[model samples]
Target: MTLDPRLNAFRPDLADRRLEGQVEARHFVDGRPERVTVSSAALRREPRPDAAQETEALFGEDVLVFETTEEGWSWVQLQADSYVGWIASAALGPRGDGPTHLIAVPRTLLFPGPDIKLPPLMGLPMGALVTVTGEAEDRNARYGLTTPTGAVVTQHLAPFGGAADNFVTVAEQFLGVPYLWGGKTTLGIDCSGLVQVALAMAGIAAPRDTDMQERALGTRLAGIEPLRRGDLVFWKGHVGIMLDGQILLHANAHHMMTAREPLSEAIARTAARGSAVTSIRRLG
Candidate 1:
């Protein structure tokens, strides 16, 4: 029997070398390496630790990979922000298809057109990951979101200049939500997902995780005050959205998911924890 050439690419040995780079989730679109899938695994140096965070450099800097396997495990790498560590194979996926946008609001949706019939999810907020599948036609841009899920989630956002505008609305909706670890839904979300989902709604695509988002956005503001409507506020290991000049909204684990506070307040909150604000980026 002959195997389809497309199926041939699914083989693990097809990956010729052990690798190192920021591991990103997969997006289901036709682009080269679409943003989707969670990086659930890692290939480590040695002596794997029982705890994930205590493992050191295991989570953030985006360096994770594994050889293909029909079974549930694979080798891993931990190289987020130059800190390297290893984690389990179960955490990662063969296809990098997670989500391009993180949900900022308690609930949001994607649709085949700008209409509200095909909503999914059981009530969520904060860090829900949404992959864009399609867009509204000129006649229907005002009513719904057409997504890859083949379900129309909501129809409130007007399909305006690309998808960036959609992000702004999504960001606005999540005025408050709690943050959580390894979380990407409204139930709990981190700073970056707040920015990610907002941008995604505007028809622009980005990563679910913050570090990956920072790299993709490019260029940081010299000061937070100069940021635009869709700008992003980033801190060491955290991120958020810049609203107006004085405020930003996000689902902070410490603050609890979905809350709009002064950017200074957020900075102070992180500072209280001894984590200083790293930088803020203008994604728009």
Candidate 2:
């Protein structure tokens, strides 16, 4: 069987030790584990800063480092979904204790202390993980102490294993977020990114790109009839969520933002662009 380079940690010169006998490489070694330390870091196709960004590694996500170059790039595979790419070495740190909670809202401020009045150190996006060590109450508001420093609003975090009741409802929160290629956060997001992030909040694991998602997610539907809420509609390189039988929601380049519209309208627009819906899928 052929292994996908994007999903497997392998290259012409080096490969993960785990794939020792499965692939050809000049050398194989065990990869070291690391954690993303920045709020987010771009995973690029090449080591250069100008290379195409394939995805973003959110804060506290785990990655297995296979190689680190003097130029400060590290070839790593994301533990969340196993996507492989080169990320900045500086963005990673020792993998400490496992995360205890995930940011549940679109975005939240990471304050230096429990008080909201203090300037925030940074903003953590939804799905960013953190190890909550304790809690504090100030001015009747609650905050969660995260690791070595910083505090985040307690209400914005959900326990690691907790899931939202409906993924569609979670997707609805980013109705107007700007469309961004290779983006995964609410500040900017793309079609698959929106789907992936929302489904994650609902405890669903999904791949990172449209084609990968089309092949890996849900059961493909045949007739496209009686479309209900939470159905996924796909085009050659695009995807949208069925808000119901009639409406579609997606972060689209056409709108340059997450938008909702009639499914029929989206169908017509896509058809006018010389493409047709490739598949419709329903999650069981």
Name the best candidate (by TM-score).
Answer: 2
Candidate 2 residue runs with Cα over 4 Å from true position: none
**lDDT (Cα, tens digit) per residue for candidate 1, span 177-247:** 55655444444445665665566556566654566677778577787356666667777677777667778
lDDT of 2 by residue, 146-246 (tens): 88588999999999989999999999999999998888988789999999999999999999999999999999998637999999999998999999999
Model 2 pairs in collision: none
In candidate 1, stretches whose alpha carbon ends up further than 4 angstroms from where it belongs are 1-164
- What is the clash count for each candidate, in the order shown? 64, 0
TM per candidate comes to: 0.50, 0.97
Q: In angstroms, how far off is 200's CA in candidate 1? A: 2.1
Local accuracy by lDDT, each model: 0.47, 0.94
Error of 1 at 126 (Å): 11
